[model samples]
Each structure stands twice: as structure tokens, then as C-alpha cells.
Target: MGTLVSLGSFCLVRFAVRLLLLMFRGAEASTFTFVNKCGQTVWPGILSNAGSPALESTGFELPAASSRAFQPPTGWSGRFWARTGCSAAASGGAWSCATGDCGSGQVECNGAGAAPPATLAEFTLAPSSAGQDFYDVSLVDGYNLPMVVEASGTPGAGGSCAATGCVVDLNRMCPAELRVAEGGACRSACEAFGTPEFCCSGAYASPATCRPSTYSQMFKSACPKSYSYAFDDPTSTFTCAGGADYTITFCPGSAPSQKSSRDSSTSSTTTASSTYSGTGGGLTLEDDSWLASLATGDASHATTARGPVPFLYSFIAAMALAYTLLQ
Candidate 1:
């Protein structure tokens, strides 16, 4: 009986420790805050990678000057875009959106993807290689609203973080042939023409053959850090340490003032980050604070969330005591 009790206690202890570690393992989740400064209501949609589970809400209404936060599990790779001029039918039917419409019609995307002429914010969080989040604002699908993505808790002279986006409104300046005037969005030349050259497909597939066209150049000139075309990866994507949180703003050039609340100590600080401006189209190495956070691969939140840990520990203790008493 004594030996049985000892063995049981040892197993329980191991199980308890494993449970606790498992709870803390999720601390590295990244929070993305979406802010609507577009002077109108916008329905933001989220799409996770095919194999990854979707985040809490697939879509939600974000009023002007308002914001919402989403916590995605580590290694979540996805894209976010805004839907405009949307309306749902009172009876059970489809939803219709003027621009960036994800076909499902209702507010929630329900796995539906945004249509072309919609600005996009793409991210690969906690990537396998270096554990840094790679993100960018893309006009490759075309442009709807001005947008910016800023990283917090970064280090350096310019804050060691790079903020990237197409903050310029390309709708008004869009070439007449490519303008979707009713929706106030600009369609990409490829979306408008669907040509092999504009789409960067077939013979134009390779980067060597797929050079930026006149239309793509216009987008590149306005938003240098954005993926103006399909082959814009070399200059568009950016990285930050895994612990950093990101803020994506619509109409960023005229973004309104707003406050943010941090839920975890391991999360990035809400310090004011400088706007990133590319001069001479050069790049620099960011600091190591983010690197250190990424190096561990298991770096998690400083403040633990309220979970089943306490109850689990109590149960384990009670079970161990009962076993000892029987012995």
C-alpha cells in the first residue's frame, strides 16, 4: 500500500507539472488590434490559413474611430480586409457588399474571402524559421481604403520597428478605366484586365519575366512597402519579434486618436511608435529585444490568464492526500 501511494503521488506530480506547463505554453499568442478611421462603418473580416483554426470572430462591425482586438494562437497565418456598403437580408438569404465583399453577404465572412479591389493586411505570425511575424499591407488585389500596420514594444533609434502600409487613398486617383466608382474602390489592373502580363501568370510567371507594369508602379510609388503586384514580395513583407502586437488602421493618413489596453505582460508595450518612411529605399537590421523573445520559441505572456490551473492543482493535492491516507 505504501509503495502504491508513493507511485501514485509521483505520477500525479508529473501530471500536474505537465498541465501547468501546457497552460503557460500559449502565452506567446499575438494580439492584432484593428482600428477603423475611415469615417464610416467597416466590417472587418479574418481568414486563417487553410490548416489553422480560425480566430474567435470571423467578422465584426467596427464603427468609425473605434477598434477591436483579436488574439490568434501562435503560428497563425492569415489576412484581414474591410468590407464596405454591406447589408444583410432580414429573411434568410445572401449578403451583398459594395466592395471587399466576402460573398457570404452577412457581416461574418464564414470562410468567404474578400473580392478583388480590396486592400489587404496579411500576416504570418510566429513563422517556423526565425519565429518572427512577417506582415504587410498589400495593394496587389487593388486598393479600397488607406491603411497602416504598426508594431509596438519594438526597440531602436527609429524605435527598431517598421510600420508599413499604403496610407494613400488610391480610389480618387485611380486610373478611370480601373476605378470602381460606385464602391469608391480602385481595381487592380490585373483584376480589371485579367491579362497574362498583368496577372503575372503563364510566361510572365517568373520574377525575371514578370516586371512591374505601369499600373503596379503607380501603387508602388504611393505605398513603397506594400505588395503592389504579385511579385512584390522582396520589398513588401516585414518582420518583428514574436512578442510584439500589431495595430492595423484604416485611413491611416487621417487616423483618429485612440487608446489601447494591454491584457498580458508578455505582450508588446503600447508605446507610441514612429511612422515608417522609406528613404532611398534602404533597409536596416532591427534590435534584439524582439529577437530574444523569438529565440525561446516558447516565450509567453507575463501575466497568466485565469484558467483551470488552480482547480487542477487543488484536485491533484486532494487526490495525493487521499492516496496517502489510504496507505
Candidate 2:
């Protein structure tokens, strides 16, 4: 009789522990950290996708050499960009920015998206902790500044989980036809010409119809891991094990030791096809590994194998304890 009671108690305890573990894993929230390394202040803007809840802030000022962090609920999908050359309204005037303006007329974008010719870091976080998160830096809209997105603290298995972005300053070498008149941003061929080929619209909507143009090639050559055009998916889109925190940095290659200083000219462009390199803030571009996987079209083996190993160990230990109590 005593043995039966001990066995029942142990089973109940083990079941309760397993339930708690599952709940704890599902409740994990991902954190996004934004770092600004530019010489000038950058106003970062956020726009959540439809049906997704709003983040803590829609827009805020991030001074040079500063950083801020935000925690969004699970299953968040949104895009982030920086607005430069912003100005506060005078008297009855409206607040505005020279580039990547959301047209909200104030610091907070209030759920508005950034205008074209702005560098954008887009994300679609997984609905659950065990799923995969998709992210990419897109020049399909255009390029306004250099940015890099790095993921950390993600599960070690499934998905490449590599760092990606356009770290080079394309503004200095932007084609004359594509350069913004004020010279702060570079317009996409689509934004400039509005043709079916460049815009990938009309008959060129599908990947089979649309193809990369000279302009898109230039962007691709400079930033191979970033989305050079609307159809750029295979090499541009990156995935990581879910529950990973990301850091998006502006002016990633502008450190003192780098080719360009924030205050000086950023004419020298660093190509992503180069060897895996580390920029400022201890972040490295995992280009080689990602490219190798891209070449073989086997991204499944990119990440180290990791799963609920800790949980399994705990469960085994609990089972042993339960057996001893039953004995």
C-alpha cells in the first residue's frame, strides 16, 4: 500500500514538472537591440505587419554611438529603418526627416511605414519558440544608409542563423540616375523608372518572368546577402531557430579602424562576398558558411544540432528519483 502511494506521488510530480517546462519554453520572448554607430543622430522607425501587435515605440531618436533595446511579443512581424536629417516643426510647422520619413509629422511614426530609398531590416518572428524566424535586409525599396542585422541566443539547431545586411555605404557610389536629388538616399531602379522589368510588376511579377538588371546586380555585388530586388529570395532571406534576439546596427563598417569614418566620406564600399569579416561592435558576417550552404542548396545543415537536450536529461533524472521512491 505504501509503495503504491509513493508511485502515484512521484508520477504526479513528474507530470507537473514536464508541464512547467513546456510552458516556460513557450513563453520566451525575443529581444531586439538597435545600435547606432553613425556620426549623426538617426530616428529609427518601426511598422508592424497587419494583425501583429504594436511594439513599445513606433519611432524614437537614437544618438550616435548609442543603443536601445525592445521586447516584442511572440509572433511579431515588422520592419525597421532609420530616418536621417530630421527636423522638429517650428510653431505650426510639421516634423519631418530628409530620408526614410514615415510622413507622420512627428518623432513617433504611430504605425506608419518608411518611405522609399530607405534601408530596411525586416523580420517575421515565429509564432512559437520551437519554430524558425525569418529576416532580411532589403534594398528592394532602396538604400539610404549602411545597416547590419545579427542574430544571437538562438537555438543551435535548424536553420543557418547567420548574420546578414548591407554594411557598405552605397550612397557614395550610387548611380547618377538613381541618386536622390538631395544626395541622402539611393533610389531603386523600380522607384526611379517604374518599368515592368525594374519594378518587377505587370508581366514580370513572377520570378520566371522578372530578372536581375544592371542596377540590381550592382546592389547585389556590393551586398550579396541582402535583397537586391523584389525577386531576390534564395540568397537574401535568412532563417534562424526561433527565440533569437537580433541587433540591427547603422553604419556597421564605420569604425575607426574601418575604411570610412562616420564624419568623413564613405566612398569605399566593402563587398559582402569577401571573406567572413568582423565589423564594429564585435559582430561578424557569417558569409562563408552561408555561401557554402547556398551553393549546395542545403541550408538544413548550416546550424549546429541542438534541441531539448536539457529537458530530456532532467526528465531522466526525475524518472530515476521516482523509481527510487517507488522501491
Highest TM-score: give the candidate number. 2
Q: What are the TM-scores, per candidate, against the unseen true structure?
A: 0.71, 0.73
- In model 1, what is the error at residue 289, expressed in angstroms? 24
Clashing pairs in 2: none
Per-residue lDDT for 221-285 in model 1, tens only?
Answer: 76677898998887677777665577787655332222222332233322222221211111111
How close to the true structure is residue 231 of candidate 2, measured as C-alpha lDDT? 92
- After TM-score superposition, the amount by which residue 254's alpha carbon in candidate 2 deviates from its true location, in angstroms, is 6.8
Error of model 1, residue 243, in angstroms = 3.2
Candidate 1 TM-score to native:
0.71
Per-residue C-alpha lDDT of model 2 across residues 1-327, encoded as one tens digit per residue:
989887798787777678667746743566687777776678999999999999989999987766777878889999999999899766768999989999999999998999998999999998877788999999999988878776664544657776677766677678899988366789999999999999989999999999999999999887878899999999988887777767777876432122112211122222222221211122233544443332233435333322233346655676677566656
The collision pairs in model 1 are 27-301, 95-105, 266-302
Clashes of 1: 3
RMSD of each: 9.5, 8.7
